[model samples]
Target chain A: MKIICNGTEYEVGQGTTLLHFLAQLQLDPDTVVVECDTEIIRREAYEGTLLAPGQNLELIRFVGGG
Target chain B: MRIMVHEQEREVAAGTPLSEIAASFPGSDLFIVNGCQVSGAYQPREGDGCWCLRKGEMIQEHELRRLLSLRHTPGVQEVISRAVVGIMGLGGLGSAVAGALARIGTGRLILADYDIVDPTNLNRQHFFVDQIGMKKTEALAANLRRMNPYVDLTLHDCRLTAANIPLLFAGADVLVECFDDPVLKAASFRLALTDMKTMGYVGASGMAGFGDNNLITTVAHRPSVFIVGDGESEAKPGQGLMAPRVGIAAHHQANQVLRILLARAGMLMGL
Candidate 1:
């Protein structure tokens, strides 16, 4: 299954959760806030929510400023 | 005797004795001693062969110590040190926030408060009984300097006023809104938002009351901000700020600052 994340495409296996993919990419969970499609995934829900194929994901990390 | 100092492919001649050779290159901190990896220390032998001192190579002990002391990430340190961070109200939340940033090597800190350290503050403010009569900023800066001699700290021994808000945060990189008063908190938010365009600053609110561990949440993004200690959450009207809860929130705030700075430098992984 193909999913787009941060403008990059990945061929993921079926029933892959966003959290699982993030872990596979070695992304730091503490640094990033993940949004699946248009909805923001609460930190508590990252572990449980599975990603559907062709999903558009946005992963934004915190940077310096106010 | 002539020694060779290599920087990339460029090699320059260094005088006899390692000390003399090292003195010649004023800006180069990295060095190589003999054939082994050494930094900051090099003693020349009587029968000296061509000793090579190269940038990015190991150095003798003396030089090594100096190099180690010099912050390699100068740009990051400069930004942190020169940047002013306003922490409102030096109570439990303010105390923790001030100390954490000072200890972590923030160059300059602006601590604002109008309270005296009360006897009760000892419970969580990390202050001694002798500090009760002293102003919060004075005591806090004293403690902060003791924690990190490198930090430059300033104190505003007064309340946050609308008139002084601009002066208080003139060059501040970020404003940490730890005031317990809801009115002041709202005021600070307004001040930050209005000046953010001019000062390039942002703020975090919501650290008050108790159950600190539960109150804390890590919020990241460009100009990362956090609201710690459930200030927005319900708490008893008369209940004062607890140490553990306020301390946890303060820690979260400090960590977010450091993480934001690191992220900006592209040095941190896992925002």
Candidate 2:
């Protein structure tokens, strides 16, 4: 299935969990805030959340510089 | 009738127009009532608060406010003057951001940073050569006070962790993420989006080195969350943080912050 993340579409396994999907992208679940379909998924919910085709995800990572 | 004019109680007629009060002060061109600008024809009731702006005067707090008010229309200046912004770091971005906000008359600033000014920071940070040994919080606070003494400043001289981030910036209407550590940045970003959802957020990323200035930009990742910078450059061996590029990103964060605060108060003017 294809899921939209940060305005880009990515193909993932059929039943990929949000946590597993983050790992595939090489993103630490603790570092990025995931907004799935307009609702913010809690840190703990990343494992239970499932990705469906065409689902919109906004991933905001905190990269540092001042 | 009793009314407070410039914090002093004075007597006026029961239905005296604000214009009459303004006329009492020579060279005055602006008038504020109850924290909002009012037309000269508007009459003041008993105990109404009032302020009259006179030209060529430098009366500390009131004068600073008057000067800022001149640049913005009525309530726009008032909204900015009443805002409280929290800055999380005191480096290149946070220092410049605070300086801009102070000059613009942001009512209160909550500044947090555990670091001290280093000789190496003179390149982009706002500290002077003599301030190298001083704490960044103290040095920045002193500089901000010099820029605008009327602005209220709250300084935290300790390092901020996810556990204390929310409490440190509790009353801030907007939070600007300016940390230099990726770990702290991520922690604060997650909390701002989740726990402190009510406050607006502006964070920076990838502004380092002497690359193309035009490449630096601001992006709205969420409704109230903004990220500024190229999102690519990093400060490494050959590349380092400089004033021009870092300042560009800093002002972007500052400008985005003003946009959020002004929009919240329904006074976002222009584009």
Docking class for candidate 2 = acceptable
Cα-based lDDT at residue B257, candidate 1: 69
Model 1 misses residue B14 by how many Å? 26
Q: How well is candidate 2 docked (DockQ)?
A: 0.47
What fraction of the correct interface contacts does each predicted structure contain? 0.01, 0.63
Where model 1 places Cα greater than 4 Å from the true spot, the runs are A1-66, B1-79, B198-212, B219-225, B234-239, B266-271
Cα RMSD (Å) per model? 13.9, 6.9
In terms of TM-score, the best-performing candidate is 2
* i-RMSD of model 1 (Å, 1 decimal): 11.3
How high is the CA lDDT of each candidate model? 0.61, 0.86
Candidate 2 deviant stretches above 4 angstroms = A14-20, A28-30, A44-55, B1-59, B269-271
DockQ of candidate 1 is: 0.03
Model 2 has a clash total of 0
TM per prediction? 0.55, 0.77
Weakest 10 consecutive residues of candidate 1 chain A by summed lDDT: A57-66
Error of 2 at B170 (Å): 1.1
